[model samples]
Target: MGRTVDQEVHAAFVEFRAKEDDKVRCVVYFCLSVQCIYCQQIRAKNTSRQKQHLLECPGLRGHPNAPQPSQPAQAAPNGIGPPNGYPGTPNGPTATPSGPSGPGTIPAPNGTLMTNGVNPHATPLQAPLQALQNRAAMATPVQATGPPSAPPSAASRPTPKPKSKNSTSSLPAPPLDDVHAAFVEFRAKEEDKCLSVQCIYCQQVRAKNTSRQRQHLLECPTYLSVMKDSIPANNLLHTFPEGDVARSLQIPAPTLELDFRMSIKMNPKVNVGAGIWGQREWVSFIGGQWAGRWGKGIVLPGGQDTQLVTKDSATNLSASFMLQTVDDPPAFIVVRTDGWLTGAKDVLEKVIDSNMADGVNPGSYKYRVNLSMETGDERYTFLNTLMWIGSGCRRGHEVIFDSFRVN
Candidate 1:
């Protein structure tokens, strides 16, 4: 028959009694020093000690039939001390022993009597045990220690992503409406095309854009004045004498259209120096042509231009001339112009000098004139009522001007 696990473990060590010994000892080691068959640790030849050693030995603990250890008395509440207070001191209160010891005796894990030991000096053990209790009361819990986890490696960390920029596109302009379209005009430039609008009510010109044009209407003085009158008001309102006379504080500015152009032939200037106002001169017209919306004509000769040359060399011109229209019997028209030819002293000297004036840029000086026409012929009755303004440039021996009619 096969031996049980307990019997096999018991047979591994042999028991013997030495000649002068009172206790039995294992022959597997020595009569006085017994060595554990499982763990090979040397122990004294005490039966109870050997038995407890067998229970705790790591080698014997592997046996299938090895005895299971008793659960340690559930730790004292909060684990401050052993169960039932201090195992009885010599004169201290005692507790019931769970082992085969005398009353008030306790067995400790190391096979020592925690109380009532045979040693009469056992009372000193109380101080260390009491110190242990005090240390446990103040002790901090231990955290588990091991190899510190390596800091997350660079490759293992997540990479931060960059934020994208928002790109917004401009919206297209609104379609032009009929009311506003009348104000906007398409104009061509040298490099590109653009739109322009003139507020008919205020005469202020601006680049034509739908939003800006709408804002202009909201703030135009003339438009606002006319709008206020067209709407009825319930409250009493103060009125200005000028505004009451015309329902508007500011009159709508007039518009001008191209009307005519004239080329006047000139004779040499006759200097009449040191007049009451300034140095004076006279320049007479020999012959020229005038073409206009009214009719094409030849300027009758012997017209005179009286000039007042100011201290700054600015010339003021007053001219009188006659025009003959082309017809079976030509009708006669009288022409008179008054204006200034003004610029920097050097520029005006260059402009007036016939020798150096031929190619001088006209933009270097200004030759502006206001003109009036008188005609007795019924065919051109409108000439007496209308007025004209013109800008002119000087050539070697002649002056050319383009005139616009004020409407």
Candidate 2:
């Protein structure tokens, strides 16, 4: 029942030591929260930078150049309570006590009570060590909600809030303040480097132009910004095909190709062994109006001459021919008329999207032929008919020509 003076002193020292430890742990948690918030602000600024540069950022919304995020603003440095009228920040800002710094926790000059900042989840034995250590620490509790096991870096920033599935997945874009700042920086330098682009309209001779102007023109009437899946404006280079007068036309059509090689194999064979033709006089195609347009051609004679062989009466009168792709596609498609006996002249000009094409003129092409709507009921042999059939013609009247108007 008796205790020595040395034992008594040791017991008292241990009690004092425990009180100080609790304070230290509290300080650590408080500092960590401050750091996390600081990091978030930094990241928000960085996102704004990327968006303004037109760098592929999926998060920036509203505009590509916004500054800080519209979420909660920064907390006070000394962990003071929030100011009145902060619309979205959490409340309980003025509560100086992090966790029940209540009765008899060491008194301090500022009559405010500080909490014991203990993570209640600490093991039972660890709690005593924490309580003793925290006596000197005045750490604040962060109202953070998430996996505590994760490190501060992961835990700091709020996760991208789940978006409505039905809504478009694109973000609203980064804040505009930062975005414009970045955009201004880019614009200042982008103009220094310009490239030459052919004018689709006026068909001016090629010359160097500013890429800056072009980039800025993403909002231009002629300049269309493709969101997704649409044809890229750059894919097409527009210029007048050939003409003395410059036209105010702009045809920015993509390259056109006839996929005969692939389509021929996939489709069923055409049955050509059984058709018949009516007899008529075959004539040379003379240039004249056909299908309401002037066609380029020479008139011979034509009226459906029934024959399988090519002859003056056949080839001369009817100028129907097969096509072969010796060059790039969009061969001009047009329409025209033959002069005499409706002159066995053929027409091709039909598909000239006037809106898209500038300075288009009066001509069409099939086998590079310059006629439209061949008349006189005479037909000429298809020269490279094999390209379409994938084999020799089975019979004279069986194989038919597939025609396309070139641009």
Candidate 3:
């Protein structure tokens, strides 16, 4: 111990005594501070173990008699140079302490040492010694001045790891069987070839495919929690109309045949009084002729047309009449026609200027009519069950109509 005694051992033993082995050999040696009574009790075999015990020993830390580096000569347990008052070791040159006054002395704060309890004047020799002491002190290790630092705080510590992308903690596993059952139920209820499916959780209709259905079951918020249970049936019902589907499914378009043709003669125009709806007019059917694959017929005389010149400048006509075929036993057919007439004013004026004898230009005007017929005759009963459409035009003083049955 050069300046300070080992803190784990008795200071008096370290300063004054020698090792038992060294005394037996007549070789003088200071007591070994590293081999202390406390170290012996714990069997500490090294300097590090001795220092560790010193740090934990309250008696050494708080003792009033503990060695102080400030009193260098008094605190030196082993002499600074060699054993038993020698100034040098057996294998080394003479050694001396670097303090201002020489070996076994401590320097004061201002790099000067006191001799005989009085301050000494600065001299060249003392100045160099003080510089050497300063360098040696700087090279020494510094002791901790405060308590050990607390454990690192949470904010300063590294963050915990994140969960994996494939983790299933937040989402439940999909219920495949329930989803399949829902699809089956939907298909069974629908009657169309292009099927649609309903979401089991929200009852929303979707395209008939497995991927979309499974996605709905797994990710839909309403059904995610209860995927294992059967979803209640919804009230949605959809069916394609049988007639429309049958019509659409036809491969080759069906052709229509001419059902019949009619030629009617009209009486002179009769002026019906104008009213709020429009100007009214009438034309009486004096007689007519009709023929087709069915036998030819005569249009009866009592038929008449009630016409309206509507405010929109269009002509609307309603006509009810009868026809009697020239068969062995003639059959009488009652006909009702509802129609509209439209034309360019100049063309209609030209036709009117021609006095209804010769018709307007063929493409300049159009007459569209819908017809309904009633008859007790067995031969023409098929007309009652079919749909019919007709187109007609005026030529001279008569109107000719060609009607076809929609197949």
Candidate 4:
């Protein structure tokens, strides 16, 4: 309390001389002058700035007991006094005190006299630090007359692009030919770069762009409605009568998957001389075995094939047989088929002759048959609704064939 330097402040501060009104001007420390005893330079009489100056001061920095700098306030650091100099001092370097001086005794023409002594060595560090500080202050000219630059206004700033509403933006545009086929193009004005197009279905008019036109067709109410009511040319529904309920159905095309293979053993043909239609012959189906995706079975004997041979040697065949599944309670299925065996006249002659048919190539002639199956067993009843087609080769007394189920 008796005019001692503050340990926290770590600076030499002199008491403020009150005005004639006896009012204190400095809010903090109640002091108006601070002469750094180490650097012997007058600093701005601010508590925080003075502390900052001591830490940055060249003379104080080397002192063992020098205070470390603390976080400073918004005001500038008190490295040196303001540009114009402090009160009682002119616009130049201060008259540094050489030793202890009596209170109120001015040391030089331009220096503030402290109520205490100034160390003689303080001048050596102050000159170099002050010159460096001054140069930095001159290099960066701070504006004191105006407020800081404000941020850009909403209207002045660039607007960010909007995200796409749907992924359709990435779709490649439809071709020009496709666009013209769907929409009728016409020019609104002779000089217009964009031609106008009218949808043939909805008659809606819009700018002619292949992508936009195609997208319009996809979303157009009238066009979608028309498409719903129309049937594609390749659709099997077109085969049904116009007003039939089946015509409105969405049916898939029939596909065939191989079901089984079978070798049918047959007895010798019984020739029936030429009838009103053609040369007729009868052949009886002997025993045979069959296997497929559903089950394995044997072809029951006693089935017959009645054939009519035309003059050109194309043979028409009608056959019927029975199949027995190998289940615990064996299921019996009825199999019936009708097909043709046609080839060169000589080829057919050899095919119809058991002796020569063994030597003929199956590929050299076509023997195809369409078959239908019927069963009373509930376990195998699904076969009753399906149809099969087979391609066969006649080898003397046996016919081997692969049957495909029509899916």
Question: Which predicted model would earn the best lDDT?
Answer: 4
How many times do residue backbones clash in model 4?
0
Per-residue error (Å), model 1, residue 311: 1.3
Estimated TM-score for each candidate: 0.42, 0.19, 0.38, 0.43
Lowest-lDDT window of 10 residues in candidate 2? 33-42
Per-candidate local distance difference test:
0.62, 0.26, 0.53, 0.64
**227: Cα error in model 3, Å:** 35
TM-score, cand. 1: 0.42
- Using TM-score, give the best candidate's number: 4
| Per-model tally of clashing residue pairs | 0, 76, 0, 0
Instruction: List candidate 3 segments past 4 Å from native.
Output: 1-256, 311-313, 351-359
Model 3 agreement with the true structure over 1-407: per-residue lDDT tens digits:
22234432232211111223332211111112232332223221345444455555554455543334323233234635333222332333323343456544554445545553222432222333334444444454433121133222323533323323353323344467766876433321212223445454565554466655665555555664353222222112643343332222213345667888999988876878788888898888989899887678799998998988765556787999998989779888888889887686656545433275264666777776878888889987866766567788776657788887667
lDDT of 3 at 222: 65
Model 4 TM-score relative to the real fold: 0.43
* TM-score (C-alpha) between model 2 and the true structure: 0.19
Error of 1 at 359 (Å): 2.1
Q: What is the lDDT of candidate 3?
A: 0.53
Q: Cα lDDT of model 4 overall?
A: 0.64
Task: Name model 4 segments beyond 4 Å from true.
Answer: 1-251
Global fold similarity of model 3 (TM-score): 0.38
